[model samples]
Target: MSFTLAIVGRPNVGKSTLFNRLVGKRLALVDDQPGVTRDLREGDARLGDLRFTVIDTAGLEEVTDESLQGRMRRLTERAVDMADICLFLVDARTGITPTDEMFAEILRKRADHVILGANKAEGRAGESGVLDAYALGLGEPLRLSAEHGEGMDELYHILRPVADEFSERAEADAPETDLDVSDDAPEDFTPSAKRPLQVAVIGRPNAGKSTLINTILGEDRLLTGPEAGITRDAISVSLNWLGTPTRIFDTAGMRKKARVTDKLEKLSVSDGLRAVRFAEVVVVLLDAAIPFEQQDLRIADFAETEGRAVVVAVNKWDLEEDKQDKLKALRTGFEKLLPQLRGAPLVTVSAITGKGLDRLHDAVLRAHEVWNRRISTARLNQWLGAMVEAHPPPAPGGKRIKLRYATQAKTRPPGFVFMCSHPEDLPASYTRYLVNGLRDHFDMPGTPIRVFMRSQNDKNPFKGRKKAPPSKLRKHLQGRKAD
Candidate 1:
């Protein structure tokens, strides 16, 4: 269910007013001030049968600096990234400002998933702005007056198909229960209490990697401080982390490859990479002040690329002055940048104060569980049927890529095997769609999903398609020979 909608426009375009109408409540603060909404506010919105999450973000501005307007602009961009669709509103009363044209260009270049709307188009006065909207090349803008709720039916009509598409995905995720999945595919993983879940914590230097591990362990076992790159080896610590037996590895600070001239630092970084490869779950910790730096994205992407379950933790969150805005920005940034870890858990924590430690612990456990999850072959094939029906395999070069069956080959970073015709001809996009489907259906969020396609090796000529029946004369000849 990925039907998220973000209402974005210039100040007083009636975004918050329309947000109030959709949610059927005055949830957001409405003021004459342009930047009344500095923080992104989300509420359950309804339009006809479609129920979705609608984000009311700060108005879009031309500024691109450290000023309040600039920050709001950046946050709005992130909120747009977080949404599946954006309802780009423009003031019809003003009749399309030059800023509106600029914003339209930006939305076109960056966010193609936009539904244009001309707010305050309740009568002939709004008709001019509505026609002017056509020049924006964002399709016919929905004429509306958010103040009086004039064009909600049109809004519902536009949102209905989006709602149905997401509904189809939700239906694919929830299958019939009468499916007996025991013998078709054996369970890939069986949880063992004796075995400790292998977890590795990796990040840039001075990101509180050591301190975070110590906080989880409930002791200052590893070294911590202001100094960068203190730990030189991949240190392993055994502890019952919140009733779950876990063997956590405290990895050294992974500096950028260009800066790694020191021989010891190279060895330390290499050792940390090894920890990530061996670990079942990887926690990419980031210093809240400098979260999602180039190195941080690389580290997080590395873990995911290595097929390990990943959890992103924003450390030192206690230092943030405005928690709500920062969190909204951080999560939006997370989804925007690390899309491979789209549904992965992101926890904000303070290692020094032990704040959000419980949330971190819970996220780790949930990640591990998802990592080792196994789906039966019977259910998998059923899911495959639904997925192919919902989004058929792409036919390239006038030949169809037929996906025959699906089975779980391995778990602990769950991998699936698909028996299909012309496996090599399958497009990467379709494969990604199925992987995403598996994640959405089986509740395996943020864990790396692997799909391997193999050609069907059936030897029988009539293996799949029906063979024509033998003639009666041929049958009589065979009977005579037998007599």
Candidate 2:
């Protein structure tokens, strides 16, 4: 395992900015607000040739009350405990505030390895604040400008020794391996066990996405409460579910585009979309009380359009009084609202009580298998012939359109290509007919299918050739004989 570094400090001190710089992407949401980030976001960071796992944590607050700020502080403290080193950042422009002093003292007591970094230490503007940071007595602070890309070399110099020590420890802890092989050994063709399945849980605000994940993990690993939009970044957690290793991403609740006006919310939504694109399977969490809302439909449609395997998880099932009727209505409404995902799995579960979780797990695995399914070319052509015979192509302008053959182009959403005489003449309705046929006949329920048409080019070889005057001579001879 790589070394872990946690960035912890009071809010709005450029911790996320430095995180984005090190990770080479803007994975965390950053804004002028004090507590924009509310979760622990992890990313693999690189500095020069040094690589390590870096965590962007919520700002620490000096509060022990059961308020939101206190919860966030507790989460950050957990991150500090998990990290190999903590990078405590302070805003040099604002000087050392009382909050910073309180956090510094906390880190001194809890974390064994701490590196004090004075951010925004660019030009002479922050010289006084940098000097004030020395009073904390942790050590001489490393002056850094996270926004302007300054002091990175010094940061690297300080991190190199730590990285080397981690590498040495890992090498010493690793067990030795010994194996003997024959000179002409046959290669194994059986499919090896796949890597952990990447699944992302997504939904609107207060839909219990984090709560559902925490239930799956059987622990309070994620911070959850009655607050809407509690999760701001896409946080990933790895776990073994029934002997299957899986990596689950808990994302911020995505609101409608029109309602998303805040810059931080926009960034959070974008991050959620990125997680969807990266995931192999996405679970669209819906509130059972008000299911299939406009935003929920939009979210499901977006996932289908992205060619991802989708499973609808209706949360808060425990709150419903009428179970049988609600389940029937939910199924009917789901099919009616999102016909694109016609047969997608709809599993009802109460994230708080952990009911129906087993069914949800099975549905997710089944959807993933269907998403990765492949069909043989012969079977595809046979199915295509049957489909074409059942519903012949439309003849427009008295020109008959012929679909020659079909072949599977790719899997993982199951794409196919059809050779035809006139590709453009094929109507959208007919294309849908073929796609639906593939989905139904091939038993590929709820999986997105792509069908492409290709027209054959048939050109005449003897074009633009002029004929001799033999026709005129033959006509004259025929007239003379008739006379």
Candidate 3:
């Protein structure tokens, strides 16, 4: 059971700054503008021996009305409530403002435990403001500057205890169950033998999805241009990235149905959708100026609905006037609009300039890792047992659904084969329950997840030896008769 920690504070206080630092990647959108962050983003956080789930929440806004701002605020509060520990950040450079205090009071009321962090506390200038953070009544503020990589040791100190406490509770509360899956375990469990993670780079016309692919390959392999929809076919390229061989699909740009009047464009769009279906990881690229269109959200939702891992790449980040603010705004928009990929990856880069390419690859790998993740049969069956105990599989025709066992059948898309009494009779909702369980038990959120139900007695059709050919059998019979 991974522990969850949420970072909450007023806008532009470097909440995302801290999140990127902890996750060891520029996953969250960061900018200098206020209210840029709109949605809550979660990442697998590692600090020394501390491994926990960290959520980067939108900056707290004081809006109570039923407007868009108010809805955004409500969503941020929900994120804080979901967290096991909230890292409440205050700007040491800006001092404790009214909004900071308001957010603190809100977290104190909602979060079970709050860890105070006075961000931007690097030089002598931030000293006075760090002192002001104590007035929030949260405890001694942990002084650190997220942008400069300052005071990380202090963060570890704060995180270790919470992680340990949660780990202990989870262990103690774990239920014992008798569901078994040893018979279905794969003969080869080697990571090398697992299929390469399938990744799709998709975006609107001229969003530079092809450029990014070419850059990743370090060659002029993928066709690129300023024109829209040049690539008609979804091209797959297999390569090794940091020792991990990944199969990347460069897809056609997805355009709106009304705008897609040409037959070629329609075929291209269908090809892109097919790539999405086959992919385990999907990277949605955006032109920095025209980010977050309805079509982009639709493509992202398609990936989420299919259980594929998703990442957002803001192409042409170098050309943007307010780079930081734009990235933050993009992330906020994604979280608010697409909750299906709640904790998806968002990376800023310039495909032409090659800025942030390394970070992009790192993000893809992390997303792939989550996409390929599989939990041990023991853990999954244990979780399944608890889930069944809480709400037993619903019975149709007065016969209860009997799930005999569960085992991971394949990797790339993180597929599972569940042995049941009657696979065809299992309801769609029951399968969803198991899929949700797999997502929760394993730290695989926002990745495409797959579940396949199979009958217990199902066997391979190609097993037994073949008899002799008719002509050979006839000759053998003739010889036997002669003898």
Candidate 4:
């Protein structure tokens, strides 16, 4: 196993800024607000040749109540426990405060290894504060400026030995690799077990998205409460589900565009959208009592537009009294509201009580399979021929449109191209018919399917054409023609 490092500090101390620098991306949300980072975020960090998993945690606060800050503190403490080493940060410019001293004592008691870092130590301005960090008794504080990219070499020097030890231990624990050769076996197209499945859980505000993810992880890894929009960033967690390695992203609740006027909410929504785009499979969580709302349909539509494998998860199912009737109604509503996602897996789950999660998992796997499925060209053409025969292309302006051939262009939300005489004249309804036909005939239900109409005439209109003459030349040519 690789080494894990957790950056623990008080709010507004540039821990997140340092995290972005190490991870080589601006992933964590940074603001003047103290508690912008309410959850622990992990990323693969690299400094020089040393690489390891680094966690950016919420600011350490002395709170134990059920308030937001208290919950954030608990989550950060959990990150400290999980990490192999803790990089406890203090603001060198402001000097060590009471909160920082308290956290340092806690780390000394709980963490196995702790590295002290004095951030914002860019120049002589912070020298006095850096000296004060020595009083924390962790060690000689690494004088660093997270914003100005200073002291990275010193940080690297400190981490190299830890990384080397981890490497040696990992090598010792590694099993022997078999070098047997097989020449007669066919190559497998299925994804390997080693690669974790990437899944993003998304929904509107207070749809129990974080709750469901917490349940899946079987721990309070995420902060959840009666509050709406408690989550502000797309936090991802790694897990082993039913023997399958999976990385699930728990995104902030997305509100409708018109209602989202707050700048912070907009950023949160954009982050969630990015998560959906990056995810291999997206689970659109819906409130069981108010399932299939306009925003739910919009979210599902956006997923389809992105050509991602989609699974609809109705959360809060335990609260529904008429289970059978409600499920039937949900199915009917789903089919009617989101026809583009017809036949997609719709699993009822209660994120609060962890009901129907197995079904949700199975559905997600099935949807992923369909998304990656590829059809043979011959079979695709055969299906196309049958579909065309059943419903011939409409004749537009006395010319009959002919679809000459059809072939799958790609998979992962399977796209196809059709060679046709008049690609532009093909009506939207006809395209829908063909797409639905492909879905039904090929058993590609619930996956977004794309159909492209290509004009068979490949001849360039400008090929072998002479350049137009200038005005004078044109006049001379006209006079010569007259003569």
Show the lowest summed lDDT stretch of 10 residues, model 2.
185-194
Residue ranges of candidate 1 with Cα displaced over 4 Å = 1-193, 458-483
* TM-score for candidate 2, residues paired by index: 0.92
Q: Please tell me which predicted candidate would have the highest TM-score against the true structure.
A: 2
Give each model's whole-structure lDDT.
0.85, 0.90, 0.78, 0.90
Worst 10 residues of 3 by lDDT: 185-194
For residues 256-340, could you state the per-residue lDDT of candidate 2 as single tens digits? 8999998888888899999999988899999999999999999999999999999999999999999999999999999899989
Estimated TM-score per prediction?
0.56, 0.92, 0.46, 0.91
Q: Write candidate 4's Cα lDDT for 243-339 as tens digits.
A: 6679899999888899999877888888889999989899999999888888988999999899899999999989999999999999999899999
Residue 50 local lDDT, model 1: 80
lDDT of 2: 0.90
Better of 1 and 4 by TM-score: 4
For candidate 1, lDDT tens digit of each residue in 1-483?
Answer: 748999999987899899889999765656565555555667789887788989887788889977656766887888787788999999988998989999889888777489999999987888888898999999988988899989899988988887888789899998678866465655433234556788899999989988888888886556555667766657667788778778888888898899999666676688789888989889999999988999999999999899998999999998999999999999899989998998999999998899998998889888988887878999999989999998888878889888999899988779999999899999888888998888898998899988899999868877788777889999999999999
Tell me the TM-score of model 3.
Answer: 0.46
Superposing all C-alpha atoms, what RMSD in Å does each candidate have to the true structure? 24.8, 3.1, 21.4, 5.3
Residue 227 of model 3, lDDT score: 60
Q: Candidates 1 and 3: which is better by TM-score?
A: 1
What clash count goes with each model?
0, 0, 7, 0
